[model samples]
Structure formats: structure tokens, C-alpha cells
Target chain A: MIKKGDTIPGIFSVLFGVLILAYIKTNEKMVVMSADTYGGIGPGFFPFVCAVALVICGVLLVLRGIKQNGNVDYFQLTPERKENLKSVVMLAALVFIMLLAWKVSKMFFLCLPIYVFAVNKLLKRSWLFTILFTVGMTLFIYLLFRVGFHIRFRP
Target chain B: MSFELLMSAFLDLLTPSVFLYMSIGIILGTAIGALPGLSATMGVALVTPITFWLDKVDGFAMLMGLWNSAVFAGGITAILINTPGTPASITQAWDGYPMYKRGEGGLALGINVIFSFVGGMISILLLILLAQPIADFTIKFGPAEYALVALFGMTMMIAVSNGKVVKGLMLGFLGLGLSTVGLDPVTGLKRFTFGNMGLQSGIAFIPVMIGLLGLGEVFYQMYDYNKKRAAEELEARKINQSLGRVIPTGKEMKKWMPRNIIVGLAATVIGAIPAAGGDISAIICWGNSKRFSKDGENYGHGSAEGLSVSSTANNGVIGGAMCTMLTLGIPGDAVTAVLLGSLMMYGMTPGHTMFTEQLDFTAQIMVLMVLANILFLIIGLATAKISAKLLNMSQPTVWAAVGVLCIVGSYCISNSYMDVIIMFIMGILGFFLKIYDFPSGPLVLGLLLGGMIEKNVRTALIISQGDWGYFVQRPISLVLLILIGASFLFPVVQGILKKKKAPAAE
Candidate 1:
């Protein structure tokens, strides 16, 4: 009774599992050492098992999804689906910017207020409260960590 | 526990900073609970990271306080405006709203606050008394037994998955696979560091947790913006919030005391069971109490007895949930799942070690839970009228603040930008998981237990020279294995029965 969407996550799982298995095979550290010894399960053994399980489940899921897909149209882009996609896309952009600010410039503090306030702005909060919240929160977090807790932030 | 240690734990809560944080948590919990869309889980999840910088004891005190008060706050709207602020408070609407319609809203609300306090108190007492014995029992467990214990936990994900057992298994296994990304626990060999220095220590689970529960929820919340808009409009209209009488008379309290005791005990037992959330505890308790009530037919119609049972049982869940989380290393419910993560962050594994070594801290948690209920009553009643103003803050504003906190909190842990990147990626992954209707509880539980399971399996294998029979040779391990098989089998059998039922219904 697996639906069509069930296969989508399963496909990703299959791809991920394959990549891990490939890496396990190629990696030097994962090799079984002292095979003559009793109970000498190597580091890769557990992950190897996990990968096999993943692949098996993935294949089962994909087959189930395919069989189920025949009974019902599974690719319909309902409004809820569109909204879900849009939410992820917008969040991704915000995250990418936040990451770049952290990595490229290390301006976590500067990016902090803008990133937070901008999301609020997008959500249609009053400009003044959003700004106040941004500034107040930035200072509070800064002092709470850097001053109160002695944890330093990135420059 | 020694009287001195118990007293010391009480004294620990008296510190100005700890008291302040507890007050803040109660205030926040009340606000979150009073708002229809906001929930205690979201309040706890959002506020969890802020406690990262606080001392461990302070952090738990704040969290426990928040947990208690947020739950109590949900009934406020039910009595005042015929709406339950949290799902657990839906029972409040049945009796409380009816009373409000009859101008006995004050009496109903007062009953709610008093009974909730009693329920929370009883639960903490049970948690305090039972946690040590449970830990003592689990202390004798071996690696093979632990492996079975973890397998048993994974099976529980099916029970708790809210009918999406397949998706639960898929994500739970995914979490286990992801947990193996660092050095192998058995061989000390790197498995999936992927050449990144940060990956050697393993994916910081705290960041992954924040990503999934915190930022992940924000993304999902934003997904159905249109629905949220309509909900917000409805919220704006339901602003007839005012507290009339916030405390119950002694005679009224005495009247419900006997029934409250019965409901409270039942609630704790039910809460100890995985997948039985606060809502279920309230429902079951209320349903059971119907036979004992004099006005049984008026059970849902302004019956103070109805308010008493529901309020008591929901809070009673807190103690049972904590006991399981602390003593068994298994989360009692979703919030305790996060609480389990918090225990990990504080370097305290939720098992026998807590009793043998961190017994004082364990005792402190028990005492603090009791105190949280007391303070929640005090602060909640004091601000009962004003706490409703919490919804005055717009939804978008709250979401925006949560978004910022998620990013910042991810970065604050270990001060690693790489963790931030990891968190962001996981946040996106978590969003999809949510959109597709997968449970986050199992994934988090799986991640917590994955390493334990792997280490135990390997150790057990090494001890018995890779004999598959080793897992069942010991009595404890045999019992655990049987339990594991039963757990996995139960769902499949239940599914078959359900299929048969569906066909007959058609």
C-alpha cells in the first residue's frame, strides 16, 4: 500500500546508500584488519550492514511506489505541494545567504539583524517592532553569550 | 534521597538567576499555551537553544518550568473563549466552555488551575520515588541486552508514528545510518569523515537536533501560509480574554481531591507508555471518571468534575514521561524526546548512571519539577489576565524570531560554522520529511540510540566470538529479544486486522 511519494524518499535513500557503500569499499580505514582473529568485525561492517538494509528497503519502497502509482495519478501538484516547495526554496535562499555571510565575511553579528529582520519584514511585521526586535535580540544574544557566558562570536 | 540533598536541591532553585529563568520560562510557556496556534512543544523547542549558554541545572529548571506552565496555560483560552489553546486542552473546551457560557467560567478556570497543580505535584512525587528503582533494574543490563533495548525502542517508533509506520521506519533507519558517519565506535577507525576535520568527531547531533525540530518546524509552518493567514484572522477575533477568579476555594479543591488522586495515578502510568501523549491521558482519565460523577450526563456540560479529571491527568503525564526518560533512556513522549537530547548535551546519559553518580542532579530535577508546578500556579495566576496578550504579537513576528534563533543557536553550539552549514542542510531535509508526513520523534530517538546499539552489538559479538546465539544465551537478553520481536510483530498483525476491518466496513 505504499503511495507514489513513498518512492521519492526511497530513491534518495537508495542513491545515498549506494554512495556510502562505494565510499566504504574505496576507503582504506574501513578495511578489515586481522581477519584471522575471532570477532574481528571491522569499522565498515556496521555501516555496510546499514547500507544493505537501506538499499533493500529502498528497492522495496520503489517497487511499492511503482505498483501503487498505477492505481492513482501520483504527480499532481496540489496547492499544498506548491506551497511546500515554495517554503523550502525561500528558506534555502535565506540559509544560503546566512551561510555565505558566516563563511565569506564572518560578519555573523552584522548579518544577524538583517537576516532576522528581513524574515520578519517578509512576514509583514511592523517595521519598528521588527527593527527593535532585531537590534534588541542581537545585543541580548551577544551579551548573553559573549559577556554573560564567555563564549565568543565570530568576527 | 537524603533529606539534606533534597533540601539542597530546593535551595539550588532559590538562586536569583535560576529563579529568574524559571519565571521567564513560566511566562513564556503561559503565553505560548494561551495562543491557539502556538504550542508547548514549539515553545520548548524554540527556547531550548537559549539555555545552551546557561549552567546545566539552570537550563533544566527553566525547561521543566516552561514545560509545566505551558501545559497549564492551554486551558485558559478554553474557559474564556471556547477554544483550547493546545491540543491537550481540547477536553477543557468540553466542560470549561460550557461553564463559561453559564457565567461560571471563573469557577471552571479556578478548578483547572488547582487540579492541574495537584496533578503535576503527584506526578513529580511518583517520578522521584520510581526513577531510582527503574534505574536500579536497568543497571544490570549488558551490551546484548542494550542492543535489544534499542531495537525495542525502534519498534516503538511504529507505535508512536500516528499510522505512518512505514515512513517512521524509513526515517528511523536513515537516522541510524547517519549516526555511523564518524569513527566506528568499535574499531576506532574512520568510516565516513569525508575528509572534513569536523566530521571526525561526528556530525554534532545537537546541531542536527536543532535543525530538525527548530528550523525544520519554521519551514513547515511557512509552507501553508494561506491556512496560517486564515487562522491568524480567527485568532484576532477571539480576543475576549479576561481572568475572573484564578484560585479555587478549599472546599471545591477538597471535593475533587479524591477523584484527582485516582486520575493522577492513572495518567502517570499511561504517560510512561510511549505514544500515549498528554491529550490521550486527559481523554482516558476524563472518560474513566464519567462513571463516578453524580451528574454523569452533564459530564461535558459545565461539569467541574470533568475539568478536574482532564487538567489533572495531562499534567500527571509530566512525571511519568520524565521517569521513563531519566530511568530508561527512552523518551516518554515528544517533549521528553527533546529532554533526552538535553540530557545528552549536559553529558548525562539517561540511565542507571544518573542514579549511581549524578543522583544529586537527578534529585534536583525531581524537586525542580515540583517547584515548576508551584511557580507556574503562582506566576500563571498573577499574570492570568495579561498572559492572553501574548497573542497580540503577530504570527509572522514570532516565526521570524524563531528563524533567527535557529540559525544563531546552530552556530553557538561549538562555535563552528561547519555545524551551521550542517544544521541548515538538515533543516531543509527535515522540512521535506515534515511535508511528507514523517514523524521527527523517531528520527531523534534513533539518532540517540544508534551509537549505543552499534557499540553494544559489536561488543556483544566480540565477547561471544561472533556467535548469533549470544544475544539469547542470557536470560535478560532473551527477554529483551522476545520483547523486540513482539513489538515488531504487533504492528504487522494490527495492520492485517485493520485491513480486514476496512473490507468488512466497505
Candidate 2:
């Protein structure tokens, strides 16, 4: 069976290389200025060098990936692996909820509790415990940040 | 440098508000560390903004408290559950979880706490006494030396990548490239902004960190959801048994103390080196302890010696990392890098000069670390038994909680909608990466150190009038270069030697 890890790096290396090349091409006008008094190097110099290094390293990685032959199937996305997809969706939805809460009302203290509740329900935990945890966490955050520190949670 | 000034500085750090904040930090730190996937770095980064309005020493103390406590608490989850709380605690799980399964969870936790405290205290003393001298030595580094340091750090990525060297290097380079996306420091011109104003500041470390480490793991956890059903069914069928009394006996303590102290000292020294972190120290110490074990076969079983060595080494890195950050402006890991940024933001540049200029703030942070370590032991021992119950919680519920925290943490970083979006996308990417066996640790480390490496290299070159020889001319830089070369080559060399020796032994 192919391992998922080997394939991930191969894809990342290729994507990283493309990104580096694109960055260099788009920012070609930027150039390093000769060093002067008061201590500063031109902005373009470091980026250019860094980009080239990335491209080189990335290429070497891709080549190595191609040469490796054993258990490459580990990286494959099978139906069995599809179940793991829920984590991604749930995480994305949570981020969306948080953003909506932040934007809609800074006082959306509902956001945290809803999140905690959803998790508790998913974990097949008792409603009582979930509610208690949600309330406890929300109150803790509210007291600590808003009441104690006087921080405003602006949208 | 004056005695009166030092006294005043010490007095300032002892204020009631500072103590309160430190206490709060320890409590929060332990809570977060006890949770799997919530790390010290995340806790500190998330809480750092709260200190913006406080005096510098108070702010520093709160951060120190969190950093010190979080490192120790990470092992609590690992010991109780088979799940490692942080990457640093993974080694602890090799033996700790087995002990927990054998109904020795309490003893394992107690030993872990005591050794963690001892390790942290020793490292802090080392920091207080040796930081200035180390700083003086580090000042000699030039651009080439920084490049070497980055190189050395990159090599460690292979170790963290879990047997994939190429992928680790690729991720590291990718991170370095990402660091170049903002305005260049020398010319003040944009490099890879692509016309977006947000890119002007480069990828925000806080958001990227949250996405990669926090959200990414959540995504990976989702894959196990179905299998979780089987696990739940199995759990239902199994009888729930209470763990017996959880304290270590004197005989057990006597058996493990000498090994713990030796491993702790070794780990402290390793962690104190710039660029090396707790994860590396813990893993190394664990490996060394196993090699030196009288009953090596007992390892990966419920060996108290195994748990003690790993936890002590991991916690030891906190104080050691801080020493480098305070004295040399060189952060040992991502969290300290953020702390370093906070220090600079407060107009306190760390270096040999910081000792003379901000004696009290420095002393206060050190003292806070020492106190926090003691407090963490107390808190950890008290809460270990209760927290272990979390291991029995349903997987779905754990995921739900993690998902919520991930979103909340990302949003809290900037309170911006765009940041949440970024976090979501990054989290998805991180999930895919994890599934494919790509190590996020190297990538995070790369991004964390990328800016430092670039800016320092450019600055050193600028100062040297473009003389590459400047790095080699310094003794410290030369030593660092050799070390970097050894870090990269030693593994390969050792593998070869091991192979050759195997035939001879046979």
C-alpha cells in the first residue's frame, strides 16, 4: 500500500516550485540596491535569492519522489479515506461560523457555545455535559478577555 | 547595570498585577496543553495580544508562565491517552500510554511532573548564568553564518518529517520562499505582493501557524470519523474500569531518579542551542535513554524510565529556548520568535545590551519561568487523574471541540473575516498534507525562521560590504557552519557505519 505522506511532499514540491517561479517572474522589476550607510539591503535581493533556492530545492525533491517506487499507493485517496473528509468540512464550517459571528455581531458569544455543542453532539456525549462545557468555556473566555482584560471583540 | 537599578527592576516585576497575570497564564497554559493538538506556541501566540496594554515585565512574565507550563502539560494528555498532545510529547507516548493502560497512569503523570520541573529549573539556571556569554559569542555571526544556521535547522526537518528527507526539505524551502512575499527590508519595495495590500506584510505567522498546526490536524482527524464508529461500538462493549490510585512509590522514584537527571541535563544542553527546540530534545533524550537502558526490552512497554526521560527533556527546552531569545535575540522556536517580536515591538531589542538596559524585565521573565515550572507541576499532579478521563470521551465530540477551537483561534488572531477564510483554506491544505505524510513541523519552522534568515543574511552582507569571508572569519560562525554540515551528514554517515558494523557483528 502506498503511504499518503510520500505523495503529499511530491505534490507540495511541484506546487511550491511553480509558485516560486511565478513570484520571481511577476516581481522581476524588483532589484537589490547596493549597500549604503545606515544599514539596509535592497528588498529584491533577498527575495530573489530565496526564490531561486526554493525552486532548486523543490526540483530536487520532485526528482527524488519520481525515483522512489515502494508503497506509493499510500498517498492515494480511496473511498475509505473519504470519511476523513468530514474533518475538513467541519473545520471550514466552523471558520465560516466564526467569521459570520464576528462580522454580524461582536457579541456573538453564541459562536463558541454553538461550536462546543456541535462537537459534543458529534462525539456522542451527553447533552448535559455538552451544555455545561459550552457554557463553562464561553463564560471563561468572556470573563477572562472581556471582563478582566477589558478587550472589545470587534467584528 | 547599577545595583539600585537592578533592585528597582526586580521590584517592578513583583507587582500584584504581574503575579496575577502569571497565575492566569499557568492555569490557561496547563488547560491548553492537556488538550491534544493545542501546543504551547499556539497558547502563547493566542494570548500574547492581551498583554499589549500591560507593562513590559508583566507582559513578559505572563508569556513566560504560559510557555513554561504548556511544555510540561503537553505530556499529561500523552500519558493519559495514547494520543500525544504535542509533537514533543510523542516520544513520551511510546512508553507513557502503555503505563496508563497498565493502570499506572497516576504514577507516570507524577514522575513526568516532577522531572519536568527539575529539568526546567536546571535549564533556567543555565540560561541566567550563560546567556550573556552565549550572546557575546553569537554576535560574531555574519550572513553566511545565518545561512548555516538556517541550513542546520532545515536538516532537523528530516528528523521531524518521519522518514522523508526530500519532502521535508521541499516544505522548508517552500516556507523560506513564502517569507519573501512581503516588502523587502533593504529597498522597501514589494517582491511578491501581487497587487494585494494584505501580502505587503507577508504571510502572517500567527494565521499560518493556526492553519497548519491547529486546523490541519483537525482535518486529518476527520478521516478517522467512520473508523471512529467501530471504535465507539468497541468502547460500548468494553467494561469501563477505573484507573487505580495514581501516585508513584519511593522505590519507583529511586529507580528512575538518576536516569531522569542525566537525561534532563543532556536535554537541557541540547535545547539551549539556538534553533533546537523541545521536540528535538525530547526525541533525542528518549532515544539515548533507550540505548543506555539496563532493560532495553522494557522500553515501549510501561517503563517509568522512558516516560521520565522524554517529559523532562521536552520541558527543559522552554527555559533553554528563552535564554537564547533574551540574550542573543535568536529565538529557538516559533513561539519564542513571536515573543522576540513582542519584545522588539516594546522597544526592547534583545542582545548583550539588553542585560545592561533592561535588567529588571529580563530577571522578571526568568523568575516567572522558574515559578511557572513549579506551579505547572502542582497543577499537573492535581489535575492528571481528572484530565485522564478525557481519553474516554467520544471521538466525534473531540473533533467538534477541536473544530470550534480552530475557528475561534484563527478568528481571534486578527478578528478579520479574511483571516478566517485564510485559516480554513490552510487548514484544508494542512489536512491533505498530513494525510500524504508531509510533516507540517518543518514547514512551520521554515516559515518561522525564514524572515530571520533572509534579513540577517542581507544585513550581515550589507555590513561586510559584500564580503562573503566575513562569516568564515568569525570563530562562532565557523563553528556553526561545521555543526550544520555535521547535522546533515552525520545521519547518513551513521547509517552507513551501522550497516557495515552489522555484517561484522554477524
For each candidate, the alpha-carbon lDDT, in order, equals 0.77, 0.69
Question: Tens digit of lDDT per residue, candidate 1, span A4-104?
Answer: 66678778878978987898888867754345433667777767877777787788777766776656434345687586556557766977886787677
TM-score of chain A of each: 0.82, 0.71
Task: Name the top lDDT candidate.
Answer: 1
CAPRI-style docking class of model 1 based on DockQ: medium
User: What TM-score would every model get versus the actual structure?
Assistant: 0.91, 0.82
Q: What share of the true interface contacts does candidate 2 keep?
A: 0.59
What TM-score quantifies how close candidate 1 is to the native fold? 0.91
Q: lDDT (0-100) at residue B126 of candidate 1?
A: 83
RMSD of 1: 3.1
